[model samples]
Every structure is written in structure tokens, then in C-alpha cells.
Target: MNPTASSGRSPWPYPGPRPGDDDPAGGGQTIADVGEFELIDLVTKGLTENDQVELGPGDDAAIVRTRDGRTLCSVDILIEGVHFRRDWSSAMDIGRKAVAVNVSDIEAMGARPIGIVMGFSAPGDLSLTWVRYFIQGVREECDRAGVSLIGGDITKARDITISVTILGDVGPEGPVLRSGARPGDLVALKGRVGWAAAGLAALSRGFRTPKAVVEAQQVPQPPYGAGLEAARAGATAMIDVSDGLLGDLGHIAQRSHVTIDVHRSALGMPEPIRAVGQATGIDPYVYLLTGGEDHALAATFPPGALPEGWTVIGTVGESSTPGSWAVTVDGRPWEGRQGYDHFH
Candidate 1:
């Protein structure tokens, strides 16, 4: 739910064929039209080779080079009906979101993405148009991050499922681990929070969701390189707000053995989100504190060292009570439900 506006165009070097490129009859093609291997070839047509990726798709495994001796890696899986719904999002939007969520982990670690490997599974009857557009969306977001979609596996499944693994280079400064936060460190945020949660609420209630808010839920645009920027500025600790703000910060606090107090007034909820709250009778603060899937960067830094897009919303402090919640708002513990847990 980062408030940042999307570029609104595919950033991929090769966007593949236009809609009319296939099936001059205008009905468009289905994945069933081409076998699995053929579909792979079509989707990977313009992936191209890059120097960082010594070996790319079509191989049993991909080879990537890291400038530093160390490499950072993160993986995530999005399952149909669980992570997203086809009716609510286009294939392209789902694809972009998959890439964004994985890439956000890399960025949160203060690393730059170098390569990605994906595993795609779907029913044989799925539309080829859907698959094609999905691949295009993935490629677009990867290209925007200057990362390569190196290689992956494809298969048949009861429903669409995308598994992605991203590799990143942390450079010499090393990754900004979540365990580094300290008392007096400033708590900062660099992307949206409540927008997606609010949008989801609107959709569930059958309310008229604003265009931007709906887009935020369907295709989150995480502040792509903000993690690296925070690292460069000497961030003490950091996390991607995939879960709700306080929930994720609780992670940082527990790991770093410190307390984090967020200032409610500093959140600056956008007008659209407020409108959504008004319509739903849901407090905007609930979205800000308990909503998830924003993928915004939240980190602790020296008070004056925060980077450009960052807004200081809190401060790290010492734990007064050992077993107490690690994160608070306006010096009090957040009273809302924590956040999403797949099995809970």
C-alpha cells in the first residue's frame, strides 16, 4: 500500500507480442493451444542473457555470480485462492505482485537483486493468454529492478501457484539484519501501509473501491531500492512490512531486544484510505496498524541519517518489561489483532 505511483508501463526490455500477435481471429489463444514446453518458449522469448547470470533459463539449473563473497536469498510462494484471486486480479497483476513480494525481501536485507528463479504451476485448461500476460508482468517487474529472471520450473496443478526465489548481492557493508536496532534509533517507513488492507475491505463489502486503492491491493509497488539506500545510510535494523506495521516491527524489536514506539500522528494516512475507512466504518488506524501486504520498508536509523523517502514515525527504546509486546503506538501497545498467519 505504498503511496508511490506506479510507472504504469511494463519496464521489461521485451514485452512480447501484442494481443493481436496471436490468433488473428481475435479470440486469443489458450495455454492448451500450446503444450507446456512450447508455452515456456513463448513466455521466455525475450528474457535475454545477462552477465550476472552466467546461465539462464532452459537449463536444469541457473548460474549467478555475486560481486561479494556472500549472497542473500529469499523465496516465497503465492497460491491461487490463498494469496490472490484470478477474478480480482489480471494475470499480469498477479505476476507483478509475485515478483514484487519476493524482491521486497531482498531489498529489506539491504541487497540488490541479481537473479530470480521461478516455478509456475497451473491447470492444463488455463488460458494461454493468462499465462502469457503473467510472464510479461513478472519480466516487467524484474527488469524494473535490474534483475534477471534466470531460470525456473513449470508444471501442472489443480490451481495456479507461483514460487519464486530471488538472489541478491549485499555488497561490502553486509546485510542490514533485523537484530541491530538500538535504543534512540529512529523508526522510519518508506512506503504505503493501509491502502491494500483498506482496498481488500472495500472489495469484500462490495463497496466502490477507488481505482488507485484497488490497484494497490492487486499490484503492490514496493519501494524497490529503498532498503539498499537505508543500508548505505547506516540503518540499524530493518524489515519489509508484509505483515502489519506493528507486527513486523515487533519482529525487529524482539530480535534487537529493544522497544519501538510509533507516533500515530506521523503515519499521515492518505485521503483515499481515510475515505475507504469512512465508508467501511473501519478506523484508518486499524488499517495502518493491523493491515498487511504493504511490503513497505520499516527500519531503525540514527535520528538524522534517514534517507530521502523515509518518514520518521517512531523511536527505538529499551524494553521496560521483558515479556511485553516489542512495538507500541504513542507509547502504548497496539490493541488490534497482530497480522496474517497462513495457518492461524
Candidate 2:
């Protein structure tokens, strides 16, 4: 399925002359020319509120109500050359990705997202139309996740940077923490794991043929509903697969003071990822074990407590030594890099 089409909304819904068109007033204006308040107006125009929103944008602060008396919050930032490249993705894709990653954090905690506030900074030379398409992407993703775009700030900077903070409610069951896994828990996962990493490899080498994997990297489809379902089904611990599966699971192991062993036979590699591996001369398991940005959910549940849509991929065991390696594949330590490291 087309990830962009999942929202059932046009990727570019703005009705106007295309970017760089011959329009004298709006079409060719840059961020500097449009100014800050006008850009805010362009972004907030037509934004709708949900039942949780008490006060939407235009005020000093936006208000959101929490039904559970507890709010779950997560923040993530995407930088221009680091997290994305303009030549590689459309403005809409970047916008969707920015929201998707942040919200995945909310879901990992077994919470329902209520709203998002964004902080956008871009070079003054950036085109106004690009900003419009970016916000359109954000709106599409917000609709897909059933969250409100309450408010955000825009400013001038040297590079385009988007910072998003998502708020969610976990209800009476409370938030699921990474530290709850027990020795006998079954490790399960929902959503695709390695596709985005394969997509990144392909894009890095100037190949984009495998449309599925490529699009996965551009806009991840984070099985948003599965998190809540897993929580309801008695998940002991959970996390979103933003980092590689092993790396994120390592967090659970460290926090819960257990060791997790992933079964290689259980992790089936998709055709697109295998194809990418074959073309790039990289092992498919590398992507499966250490790939990041897929936003898949991984959790530990009691035996026979597996929920629908989740596949058992590993088992949790007691750690023999304190402060030791927390994750293993096929009962041994992984040989190379565990996952993405920002400063590595």
C-alpha cells in the first residue's frame, strides 16, 4: 500500500499556482519575503480542533485536556542534511516523517495521541510554497493519527530544522514503561522492521527502484493502533523501533534487568529488503537486526498473552552478569554496530 495514500488525502491539496510559477504576489516568494506572522497565518489557516483542544493556535499557549489526568509527551528533531535531504524527498514526505517519529514515541508508551506543537526553522531563502506543502504533509499525518495540530513556532535559520513535541493520554492502565519485562516474557513485534534501513541504503547509493522500501524511508507507517492493542492485551514492556530492533530492545533489557535473545529463524526478511541487500552486497540480517526509523513496535508479554498483529520474535531471560550486553541474536552477541549513533 502507498504510505502517502494511507491518509486518503491528497499529498498536495493547496490550491494555488505551483511553486516558482508566474504569479506575481505569492508564487515565488521566499520565507524572508513572506515574513514571520504571514507564514504563521499560512500554516495555521484551516487547522481544525478536536474535543481535547481547549484553546488552539493564535494565543500565547495552546491548551489540551487530558482525560486520564496523565499526559505522555515526546519530542524529536529533524535536521536538513542529517535527517533528510530536500533532493531526496518532497516537502510533504518530510512533514509526515517529522510527525510520525515523534508520535511513535507516544505510542511506544501505550498512549493515545492528543495533539502536537511544532517548532520550525528554515533558511530565509527557502520558498514559501515548500513551507505550504510541508504543513500539508503535517496536516495529513495529524489526520491519520487523529491528533490536532495545536500550535507551533516558525523562524529563520541557516538550515531547515523541524522539532515536534507530541502529547498523549494513557488512561487508567497508565503508561507502559521499558522497565517492566520479566525473565519469562515473550518478545513480540508489530509493523515492518528493516524496510526503511534498506531504503536508506538504496537511496544513499543513488538507487530508488524498490518503491516500497524507498517510500518506507521517506514516510514510515508506524502501526499506530497496535501499540494500544498490545498495552490492552497486557504488554509488560514496549518501545517503538526508531533505533534498530536490537538497539531499542537493548533498552528494555537494560531497564528491566533482563537479557533478550532474538531468533533469526523467526525474523523473515521481505523481498524488497532482500533485493536491496543483494544489490548492495550487504547482509539482509544487518538491516533486520540493526535498521532504524521503521517505527515498528516491540514489546514483551507473558507467554500466551500475545495480542493480534504481533509476532513473537524472541524470549526474555535473566541477565547472568550486571551491566553486560543486554541483547543477543541466535543466543550470541551481534558482531558489529548495534544501531544508529548520532555522533559515531
Candidate 3:
């Protein structure tokens, strides 16, 4: 069962039709049929091992090198039914999402991801076909980000959960932190906001949301390569909009002791999101201000110095009010929910 790269036997056919595509009825082959080792071999096939990977997969641990002699790392975990539901997302979406979220964290630090390692816990009875597609999803995402999946572990569990850890390089400029924002800095963002939340809301309410909205909810596309560009352009502070714009920005406010004032007029909700709000009778602003899991990068930069593909949303100012820091809309404190919290 210990199938290695040199084993000379491939468990499944790749570069062909995807799993279950041949048998749309999903003929009964489960993970038990393929076993863990064979599953590993199938997934690891064709994965590019970059020069940074001193020791790639098939080993107990992987060794990755950083160009700057310093490394930045971040981890994110997605549990079935908590972060996503299989009924709502395809295996490909789930896999891509798992990596995208982790990559977003590395991007938030203004770093370029070099390697990724994943740990998958799944039910032994799960379909082998499904598992293969999931791995394809993971591999595809890694390729999209120009990084390699160095190594990972698979095991049996009650439910599917993916733990992804990404390693990144910050180069000479250094990693961006949430604490660097200062008064007079411009608050800006790259990529969409509130679309995921709006899509999630539609799914919850059983509303037939737009295809774009649904895709946004299931598979997020973080502005790749923009983080490093921002850092190179002298971005003071940065964060990924994972748990809503205000909530994520609040992290910067708290860390840097600055108040961020968002100009609502300038932060217009996209047409798709506005349409969702109109259909659902929900305020688009609610989604824009408090929605989460968008994976967009929100940053603060000097006036007139915002990087390309970034939109100015607000301005940072000295925190002269109560609490450690604050966020306001048009100079007024927001009274609604700031962002998502795991616990109430």
C-alpha cells in the first residue's frame, strides 16, 4: 500500500476524463478500494517540485528553502459542514477553496507563496472518485498560484476536514503586518467584497442566486501577485477580507491604534451584489460592510499611491475615540455587526 513515485504502478488514469465522468452513475468504488497509499500516488503525480523544495513528498517531512533567509507561514482549516457543505460545493470548489484561503493569509502578509502542505481527514467510506477529484482540485489551485504541494498526510475521520499550511517568501521589503497603518493613510481593497456572503445568504434561503454569485461563494479568487506588488509599492498595512471588511480592518485598527473611516459612497456594492440584495430584501450594505470570506486584500497606502487593481475605500485617521481603535462610515461609528465571529 506504500505507493511511491518510483513504484512503476499508477492506481488511476490521469490526463483523461475526471473521476465519475466515465461513470455518471458513480459505480461503487470507495476509498477503501484504492487505499491511502495509492490515493497519494494518484494525487502527487505531475505535481511540480520547485527548486525551493529541497525534499519533496514521499518523505515524512518536506524541506523548503526561502530566498531571503526568512520565511512566512500561515495555516487555515476547513471542516465540512462548518466552513462549507459538500451539498453546496463540488469537490473541485472545496479543494480550491481550501488552498485559496490559506494562500490569502500568505498574501495578506505581502509575501509570495512558495510551498503548500495539506492534511486531509476523511471518512474511509468516501468515494474514491470523489477523493481523486478533490486532490485534482488541490493540485490545480497550487498550480494556479505558482507553488508546489510539497507534502501532506491523509487519515480517516468522522467528517472531511482539510488543514492547509502555506510557506511564503517576503523578499527584502519584509512582511506586511496589520499594525503598520497610520493616520492619513488611504484604505483600499483589491478584489470583490460581500459577494460570497450574499451568495451564502442565497443558498441559505434557497434562493436561486446568480451564477457569478454562487461561484463567488463556492470558489474565491484572491488577487494573486497583488500582495507582493503592494508591498513593493510601500503598502503600510494589509489584511485579507476573510471575515468581512470591517472585521478584518478592525484587526488593523486594533494593531496600529488607528481609526479607519470608510466612505460608503465610494464603496459601492457591485451590481451583482446589489441585485442579490434587491431580490432578497436585504441591504447590500450589510453584505458589503459585514460579509466575510471574500479573501480580498484590504490595505492602507499613502494618498495617491494605491497600487493598480486596488480601489480606494476609506482613509485612516488617529484613534481619538473610546476603545482600542475604531472604524467608521462617513465619520460615524457603525452600529451594526462589525464582522463574523466564531462565537457570539
Candidate 4:
């Protein structure tokens, strides 16, 4: 049996990158036909993950420790055609995002990442160098987050898919869960919102966005270390905005049993995105409130938990049990669509 077992197998037994080879498949039976390991090895070719991890790849399982007795972990998956497409994103960009977003979630929890485990499924035709570059992307991102990648599985499939699971140490302090927000808690956010949606709009409509917007879609550089800062600064409850703001805040609301009111007055504005809204006839609020993949941190504070990069978005109120999941723009009952239903 392969060492990885159920996790999958290495696609290529040879080391990183084969010159003149230009595809993930290695020009043979499709990736699914080779199964998992071979395909993962093909894509993950490259420099080793950080040495911090106790067990790095190739085993029945990988191991990392949680000194605080609690482990803060989160997982996010990207489907080839749904979440991202190889056509728009390079292997490196995809790799970077796969790592960055996971770290962002760990940060949002008010913890620091200890290690990462990744699961990749792809076609057999991709090139070997592509895999190495992808790992490099993960390593570079892990370096930024002060974490190392322990290991993960590689598999062959009909399409490209990446699932990243991050493990974090809660330290002795926080794991600011969603249920901790209290009434009168101040709403705060780190990292810009709506930009990724704008970039997606630009791509979908073929609108040439400024470099910044396009970059937003390709690789999101969330405010690094901000989650721990927020935690240390005393964030009561926190969450990462992987979903739209209203949609994500609904999480805080449901967990904290409060109503969340978003202030439109404080929104970040620029001509290109506003112009994109006008051109595409899509509401900017939709982008601001419903867009996902921004991976920004949204947390609640008891009274004053303001950090340098944090912005006040709104407040936590009595539960919406009276029939309002969110507050209206004008402070009335927000009874519109609850936003983002993953199934449809």
C-alpha cells in the first residue's frame, strides 16, 4: 500500500519539473486513470514545505500540536469551474490563494497557523513544473503566515480542485468564536471588501479593470497578522468574510443572537469599481455585501477593539428573532434575500 493510503498517492515518483514536459497529465491516460498520488506529485513538485511541522507529508497521517489544548482549524475548497478556472488563474496564483485564504480564516479566529494540509485533484495532463510552482506558492504564503505545511494528498480527477485545511494554535488567549459577540459590540473589519467582486465583474463582462482590481481576483493579500492583532486587541467574536458581508455577518448574527447593521457611508469607493457597477448594472452594495473570496476579517468588539487597519462597519443589536435577519440601509428591517445559498 502507498504510504499516503486513503489520502492518495504521488503522481510522479521523480523529483520536481521535467524539462520539455508541458502538461499535468505527462501525456498519458488522464489523471483519474492514474488515480491520486501520481497526480498530486505532478502538481506539488518543488521545494519542501517548512520544517516547523512535526510530520511533513508521506505517512498514514500528519501531526501538529496545540499548546493551548484547543486547535483552531478551518477548511475551504475551490472547484475548478465554480470557484476558479485555470484559464484565468496561473498555477502560482491558484496556489497562493489556496494557502492565503486558509491562513486568513485561522487569523480571523484570533489564532496563528501551525501547519497546513492540502488536498489536490486535477487532470493528468498538467505539466510537472506547474506542480512545483504551486508548492512554492504555498510555501511563500506559509512563510508570510509564520506557518509551515505539514502535508496533504494528491489525487487524479476529471477537473482541477483544491481543498486546504489549516491547523492553528489558539495560544492561551482567543479563538474568538461567533457566539461571543455581545449587544453594543462594535463591528470591525480588516482588509478591503468588494474589490474581488469588482474584479470578477471585470472578468465576467470583459471590462478591463485597473491592475489593482484584476490582482484582487487573482491573489488576495489579506491584511497579514491582523487576526492575532484583533484577538490581542480583544475582539469578542470574529469571522472571515469568505462569503458576502451580509451573508457572512449573518453568521455572527445567528451565532451571537444579534442583528447586524452595515453602514453604507463607510464603504470604500473608487471610480473604476463604481464605474463597473454602472456598466454592469450590478449594485455596488451587492458586491460589498454579497461578494465572497475577499477573505477579509469581520469581528465584533465589546466597546473598543479598534486596530490600525480595522474599520467600523456597524453594530450588534438585539436578535432578529422579531423577523429581521439584517437591518435595512435606513435602519429599518432588512428582509431582503439572506444572500449566498451555496447550493444555488
Candidate 5:
């Protein structure tokens, strides 16, 4: 029998409205009313255990079954005001975005994500209905990625803060590193790049008619299985494109001791992105080059080894001189900002 049930507490701590319930405004019971323990019960209840989870929540720690002896781990933190705005995104969107961004890091290493543990802190006045929907989003993303929600911790804070740590395995091929790109490798991309940035621009101007771009900003759609496929196809190096394309590629260039040059022609501007750029009087290339949070996969592959769904965008070359630019567009240095800066 479950210890929680034996203690005479209701199995479902949150007996209030669920995701699609009429309480879309989330006006009912607040976190302060439910308290901490019961809130934990609400978050952990009915989590689906996968084959990789040897032990899940209720234990001091989770035991995850890794195929290879090695494990890959990555963490990402999202603060309310800094990383998200409640008015712009729902609790569910925020939850899904948190999981997607973290999982992309694992995939970037050419590994399979197995499980995740989250640390969530929110103000006491936050509604329990919001919490329920947020957990639902987390669970939905975990299911989509075929990973398990093993465990997590919750606490009270002035603002909502989400910290997620994802665990992955690289199998026998071993994890791909950012330092593996060679001078002769081909640079490729395997996901959307500028859609989120365009979406953000739309929302900032108080117009959300373009539903596609708007939704892209709220919940990123990362190419999940492409990382392992690229690894299997003999990718030299890879990275998750969370902080713009050129900026992220710069990391690979610096670590791999190679210079990367992106061809502008290869990155054809999508119609929607162009429309956003036109309306805002901003160059579309700016979004593709310096916008962040797309969570796309960028990698280098040997000649003729490119996998399906990956578009070759650039070429790796020897660094010409010390302190030379790591990444360039159409053989020239990018004029303005490189990517997002937390402080700037």
C-alpha cells in the first residue's frame, strides 16, 4: 500500500480543476493554501516510469539504468522575469519549454535522454491550477522525448524559477564533443532557427496574429532524434542552437581550433520570418544569425556523410590568425551583436 494513502491523506492532493477545466484563468486554490508536501504530491502523482528508471520518486534518490557505463548530464535554469513572462506564456508552455531546452543539451552531445529531475520554486500566491497544468506540460514533453520524470524538489520563492537537469547516455559510439570539428568538415543544421525570435518580436509589439511564430516563441519544437542520427552518421562535432546560430557555432570553432564560414544563401529566409522582419523594419538575417532559444542542432560531418534532414550551411576551415573571428558570414565578420547576453 502507498505510504501517502496509509497516512489517510487523499491520493490526489490537487482535487481542483485540471488542464482543460473551465478555470483557464487559474483563479482557484493557491499554493499557499495547499502548502509544500501536498504540492509535491500533486506534482509527482501518476508519473509514468520508463525502462530506464530503476527507482523513481519517494526514494531519497532515483536509480537510472544506463546502457553504457558513462552518463551525460546537463542543467538549465529559467527565471520568471529573465527567461519567461507569465502574460506571454501559460504555465503549460513554460513547463514544456523548460524540458525542451534542457533535453536539447543532451541531444547536442549525441546521446539519448533517459530522465530528468526538476527544481521548481514559485510564489505562494500562485494558483494550484497553474501548477497542475505546468506539471502536465512537463509530463507531456517527457513522454514525447521518451524520457522519464524521475524526481524533483519544490520550494517557495518570490518569483517562479525552474531548474532542470537531464541525464543521458551516449551508447557505444561515445558522446560527441564540441572540439571534434576538423578544418575540412561540413557544417550543417537540423532544425528551425529564427522562428522564436520572430515570434518574440511579434509579441513585443502587442500583435499575435501570426500564430505559428508566436507559438514557436512560447514552446520550441526541437528536432529530438536527429542528434543520435547525426552521431551514428559520423558527425565530427555538434551543439544545441539555444543562443543563435553563429554564436553557437563560434563555440565549436573555438574549441575545435577551426574557423567556420556560413553561406547566407544556404539559409534561405522563411516566408513568415521575412514578413516579421518587414513589419518590424529589421533584417531577417539578424534573427537567423543572432536570435536565441531555437534549440536547433548544428553539427559538422565529413564530406558526403551528411544525414537526411540536415542542411549544409557552412564549411570548417583552419583559423588564419590568432584572435581571428571564430565564425563569419559569407566570408565577412558579422557587424552587430553575436547573440543573447544575460547581462546585456
Candidate 6:
């Protein structure tokens, strides 16, 4: 809402609301409302720690152990009005998403995330209670992912921004990489795709569907154990569906120098996606091909049938062949929205 129209100023629904009501508290209190040390203290209370995090929260950096020889790490940032706005998400929602997306990278690498490092910045007047609630969401997700909070920092800034870096371990199995795929392999996924984008579209258009789709845009439902399952299933190249499936698959295709063909009909959420498309007047396939942040596990399986929950979305073909590195929905060529580009 426009600031002047509100009580002097208002909270951002800069993106709009879910349905019935909107509130101004999303902005929290000003910095003077809670002193920095007090604010920091509030956010750090009641966190769950792990054995690996011997020293956590409050030091210059948190310390963690890697019993294995190496650690896999991934980082992600959510910025106000950019990655998300208060109007579209709650503190708890953002916190859960901040953690889930970071862990999805670890999942993509065929590892289990063990720890997190967070950096948060917000206006000086932000509420200590709100920050604490955000951390509660993080803790809730960490419990699901079996991760612990090693450490993090808090500071006042012009806008609300949060970044999380996850540290994961794969034990003796090692991590999966982009270039390991080859020709003649079946491409597959473990979770739903395009739902997050569908939800985002709904929010953008002032529409409200099931809370399931709305929650998807706030925090995706990833295939929790599928990453490691794929690794054990002999998946060669693997990635999280952080970007649109087709676009992300393009990354693997380009990196592995293989052609990727997606069997669009096999996607898991065809019915729901089509329903969303019908409600919004968009092609449901567009959401599957270009929507992202579903955190589905996409991988290459050596010539064979797929595993349970895994669909053979496409096949890998020789890169040397004509029109190699191509990704299509159905037999026709598909060129649609690429995933999020930070520089844009």
C-alpha cells in the first residue's frame, strides 16, 4: 500500500496479500525499539545445536566438524522486494524458505546438510519477537532436514535481507557434480515441479487458490530423502529444481555436453498444474517447463528404468549429435522463461 494512505506509513504488501486481510506489523519495530544486542540475544535464544557444532552462535564464526574428508557447501540470499516482500510472506515463511532452499543445494549434491550460517539485516526498528519467530521457522525446518544452526550474525540495515549458507556431508559416498552425466541415460525427478511458479503467478495476479499452492511459493516441498536415494541409485548428474525444470536441465545438458529431452506428460503434478493453468489462462506446461523453486531432484540414470517416485522425464542423447544440448516439452521445441537471474 502507499505509505501516505496508511497510518503515516504501512507494512509492505508490496507484492499484495493472500486473501482477506493485511497488517502493518511486517515492518517490525524500529532499531531504537530494540537495542542491537537485545535484538541479537532474542533471535539466538532456544536454538537447537548438534554435536558437530561444538562452538555456536555469538562468536565471530561458528565452528563445525567434517568427519569426512570434505564438506559440500551452498549459499542463497533472500532480499526484501527482490527475492520476496513482506506482503507476500510471513517472517516464518521466509525463514523456512531461507533454510529449505539452501539445503536443496546440498540435496542436489547428493549430501545431507548438517549446519547453517545465516546473515540477517533489517531496519533498526524491527521487532525482536518477529526475528525470534523467523528463527523458530528455521529451527522447525532444520529439524526436518537434520541440520543445526552453527552460527550467524545480525545487523541493522535499510531493508530486510537474509542469507543462509549450508554445510553438508556425504560420508564416503562423495558429492554429485554437473559434468558426470553421459549419453543414453534416463532423466528423472523425485518431486513435483512448477507448483512454486504457479503459486507465485497466483499471488502476482491477485488470485487465491488452495493454500497448498500459496505455501509452495513461500516454502517449497522438496523430495527430502530423494537426493541421497538418487545418489545411491547411481545417478550421474543431479541438481535441485531451483530454476525451471527445463532451464535447470539445460544446465546439466550444457555442462555434461548431452542433449536432454523432457517427456512433459510424465510430470507429477499434471492435474493440479493444469487446473492452475486453467484458472489463470496459461498453459500448464509452461509452468512445468519454466517454473522453478520446487526443489525436485533431477538426475541422470544409466540406461534402465527409473526408481520409485522418479519419472523418466527425458533421455540423454549424444552431445555430438545435431541440435545437441536441447530441452523440449513434448516433440516441439520449448523456449520460455529462464529461471531467476540475480543480475537482472
Name every residue pair that clashes in candidate 6: 29-125, 29-126, 30-124, 30-125, 31-124, 31-125
Ranking by lDDT: 2, 5, 3, 1, 6, 4
Question: Could you tally the backbone clashes for each prediction?
Answer: 4, 0, 2, 20, 0, 6
Greater-TM-score candidate between 3 and 4: 3
Q: How many Å off is the CA of 51 in candidate 4?
A: 7.0
- What is the per-residue lDDT of model 4 for residues 41-122, given as tens digits with 9 covering 90 to 100? 6544553555446676677788786775687778989888887766556667778889988998888889888888888877
C-alpha RMSD (angstroms) for model 3: 7.8
Which 10 residues in a row give candidate 4 its minimum summed lDDT? 1-10
* lDDT comparing candidate 5 with the true structure: 0.86
Residue-level lDDT tens digits of model 2 in 1-344: 22332235443333433322334344687888979999899889999988998988999999888985788888999999999987667778889999999889988998888999999999988887788778889999999998899999998889999999998888866588999999999999999899999998888887655878988998899998787888888999999998899999999999999999999889897999999899889999999999999999999999988998889999999888875547999999999988899999
Instruction: Name model 5 segments beyond 4 Å from true.
Output: 1-27, 322-325
**Candidates sorted on TM-score, descending:** 2, 5, 3, 1, 6, 4
Candidate 1 regions with alpha-carbon error over 4 angstroms: 1-28, 321-325
lDDT of 1 at 293: 86
Of 4 and 5, which scores higher on TM-score?
Answer: 5
lDDT per residue (tens digit) for residues 1-344 in model 5: 11112245333222333223445556677999989999889888888888988998887888788896788889999999888887677778888899999899999999999999999999998888888878888988889998888888999999999999999988976588999999899999999999999888887886663667877898899999889999999999999999899989999999898999999999999888888899899999999888888899999999999999999999999988863538999999999998888888
- Per-residue alpha-carbon lDDT of candidate 6 for residues 93-198, written as tens digits (9 for 90 to 100): 7788898999899989888788999888888666554565577778788888888988778777888899899998886655778777888998988887888888
Clashing pairs for predicted structure model 3, backbone only: 242-293, 244-292
Residue 207 accuracy (lDDT) in model 4: 44
lDDT, residue 116, model 3: 90
How much lDDT does each candidate structure score? 0.83, 0.87, 0.84, 0.73, 0.86, 0.77
Q: Worst lDDT window (10 residues) for model 1?
A: 17-26
TM-score of each: 0.90, 0.92, 0.91, 0.84, 0.92, 0.88
